[model samples]
Target: MADDNPGFSDPVTLFQDVEDLKAQIARLTGLIDRLTAGGGDDPAGPGDGDTGAPAQDADAEGEEEDGYPPFILLLDSPAYDEELRALIEWVEGVLVPGYLAEPSSDAHWCHLWFEHPVAVGRLHALWLAWQELTEPATCGYTGPSTWHRDHLDPCMRELRGRGGPFGGCTKNEHQIAHRQPSLVPSAWRMAES
Candidate 1:
């Protein structure tokens, strides 16, 4: 039967080839997970603690001084006008107020300790939704989801180097739209109708 088709290969060789491919895929997947999950380091690591000394010194120095580290917000894309507006509203109304005040206020610092994975996961979900809404080829282009998964570090670094938040970090759009899911009803509903 193998000889009947000119393109046919040996069954044992095919099986071996498939096994090798599977092994390689597994290895690659493990690597991706490690790389994405803060490379084995704790997401909310030691840096988040208030050393107390420096802050106290700064407080003693001057209350009006620019002591607080600036905030960073990473948006997935500018194309999803409705969702983008909704996200901006969410940042201003909900997320910023909830996370940037009181006990969790330290999380506002880009350099401070944080649940990096959780933040990254949330950004990733937003990125996915953004891709679905903007990219015509995406499965949910006309569906509900409207966010994308944007990496914060690069965007933050760019913002820092620019000396302000208006540097236009749109260059990282590709990275922002990766590793996202196809559907996100909550995000879709959150967008302006």
Candidate 2:
């Protein structure tokens, strides 16, 4: 018998695809929940814990939900999934460009940025903060600067400092340590010379 579908024709590949789609759907559902239900303070990011004040809608909306941002859906948090890949790309293309200018740091970003669980968690939280802080004040936000101060700063310190994610890695630009050992085992890193 000929296989009508070469890829999914095999039960194993079909099962894997089904599982991936289900995971994607679950992640999206959680994202929707975060958007509507307001985010709670994720343990990873700064400004965690209650203020003993009313929760602003913008503040609530920025919290990372259980499934969250979906960059963390896998056991190893690989960026092979399209949505997860897009998130990492945004951090690489947009966030890094907007904030840091050190070529060595950018090299560090290329090398160690994605291979740390804490980095991934903090970045996702920071992105949520960005979303909340960028909304207008009428949306109950003070503005995007809060994200810079509260979320972005500390994460930057951890991800970019000498003792940060790139610790023990080469400090050369136009060159990277190239996927040196990740601080956290869960994040998937790619080596590009």
Candidate 3:
């Protein structure tokens, strides 16, 4: 049967191809760094608790419920901007396709709910930078909680009062209710007893 045909490429092969692609990416990245620094010292390798290493078996098992495998992409200063863009594009393009093709594969499984805390923090910082660049008035913003709350609170109240998807909810509450659940076991809700 075609399903059992030896000539057919196995799922393992596809995964290996993905790994090979990632290695190629790493090599290309190294080359880019070398060129950028004009042959300066290689940036420090991944340190402890860094995102460069594969997730531990325990972590993978713990995260299984989220439907995505966990992996890391450690980026030093020079590689941050370009690598983040490439990583986001990979999530949208390559990773999504692979997940759709074989939802059960390790790659698909781990990546489905993959979380790189460092990358996320970096992205958040970048977002703040962009926001500042685009809207300077939004700067010095104490957000929603402060003695300045009186000034901001009514504005936020008026906005929330206007009624939308989050009509009456605070941002924190909205995020908690609507944000994507993490792959970590903690994110899983226990079945009703």
Identify the runs in model 2 with alpha carbons over 4 angstroms from their true place.
Answer: 1-80, 103-108, 137-141, 171-193
RMSD of 2: 18.7
* Cα lDDT of model 2 by residue, 61-142, tens digit: 3234432333344424233344346557768877978887764634345345565655666776676566545544212333
Give the number of the best model, judged by lDDT: 2
TM-score of predicted model 2? Answer: 0.45
Tell me, what's the RMSD of every candidate? 20.7, 18.7, 20.3
Off by over 4 Å in 1: 1-79, 93-150, 163-193
Pick by TM-score: which candidate is best?
Answer: 2
Give the C-alpha miss distance for residue 174 in model 2, angstroms.
12
Every candidate's lDDT: 0.35, 0.52, 0.36
TM-score of each: 0.20, 0.45, 0.20
Q: Tell me how candidate 1 scores on lDDT.
A: 0.35
Tens digit of per-residue lDDT, candidate 1, span 105-151: 11222321122333343443443333233433222222222121233
Off by over 4 Å in 3: 1-78, 100-193
Scored by lDDT, model 3 comes in at 0.36
